[model samples]
Target: MSFAISSNDVRIEERDGHTYLIASSRDEDGNYNHTELNLDECLGNNEGSFNWSGEGFTGSAENIHLSIEGPEQLPILRAHLRDSEGNTHDRDVNLSERIVNDNGCLVFQ
Candidate 1:
């Protein structure tokens, strides 16, 4: 129902060579509802900025930057979003655990 605002609130999962970016939170029923994005389709390179807006997701982000660094090229995401009420939020997430160094290429695992 809301945006995932921290590294701890986000999770990356790899399945059948596809990488998924997931965020979850509890609903009014006390059940966890998940929001997922397919990174393989949206993420074109190691580092770039993107914007996403739609229904069933949270706030619309005007700027969502993704970058990879260090020896292994681990991922880091910074997002700035505006909610329906015009409230703004900024989020920074370190997504290193799901990224693996395969030989020299950065692969999602």
Candidate 2:
């Protein structure tokens, strides 16, 4: 009974007119688990960092945490996820900067 979260699983989506930062992962039973966040208040115009720590619904996971931050001004990718085994894996760069552009802005073409 061991599960964990990854920083690479972070994604920005707009649902119900709300921009949420959804961190997705699988639990010990291979069940999909997601943690949502309101990026509107979490991050501002300038750039900020955040940490989220929690366990899966099955409780068979480590208290994994994902840190979100951006606007490095130089493509400073700093997203890393610590697995249940305590291994820190690096995520994509500039993944957090897209939130400002994708928050409430959509295109129809």
Candidate 3:
């Protein structure tokens, strides 16, 4: 499929207390730096706009069934983002919480 840059922000889905990361970008090789951006990098210590700082996530999505194993302490999240053409990108993310909250939100540090 052809790759296209998405001008939209990432999306999150919360269901039965579990949170899922969803974006226009798909999770695949050759799409990381090209399409995906980490939570810290996306937030950029409060520089870039993952669009999360203000408006937050804005897209319709479904729960991700894939099991994402995280570190024991201060887990680093590997969130997947999608491109305009639906190519997935994986982003290594760090959330603000010391321990992950119920909904698995990617709040940058």
Candidate 4:
């Protein structure tokens, strides 16, 4: 399993006062996999944290933390994942540029 995630693989989306965090990855063979976390549902708020596990680039995230940073107040998520192969990954997803629009409304404040 060579799955990996970076800032570029993360996205934040807002819809009807709800927020979501999404991460995606593509393998060398062009297989795409994604995980979507509803912030309000999983973490209880817009800027919150949660844990997840999946397949292919499958892994588990623990001690997940989310926060806002910089003058623009962008969302940031920090977590460590252990792949199925037992490889560990530490990632800080700066969600500033990865914010996506949902139904023509996407804002983080």
Candidate 1 local lDDT, 13-40, one digit each (tens): 5555555666554444555555565655
Candidate 1: residue 99 lDDT (0-100)? 37
| Predicted model with the maximum lDDT | 1
Lowest summed lDDT over 10 consecutive residues: which window, candidate 2? 53-62
Clashing pairs in 3: 24-82, 24-83, 25-81, 25-82, 25-83, 26-82, 26-87, 26-88, 26-89, 27-88
Predicted candidate 3 versus true structure: per-residue lDDT over 1-109, tens digit per residue: 1112221234444544345444444333423221322332232211221234422222311222222233432233444444455554454443323212222222233
Clashes of each: 0, 1, 10, 0
The whole-model lDDT of each prediction reads: 0.45, 0.35, 0.32, 0.45
Better of 3 and 4 by lDDT: 4
**31: Cα error in model 4, Å:** 40
Give the per-residue lDDT of model 4 (tens digit) for 12-104: 555555555665644345555565656544332112223322111112544466566665555676666564565556766554443343222
TM-score of 1: 0.34
Error of 2 at 37 (Å): 0.6
Q: Which candidate should be chosen as best, given TM-score against the real structure?
A: 4
Sorted on lDDT, best first, the list reads 1, 4, 2, 3
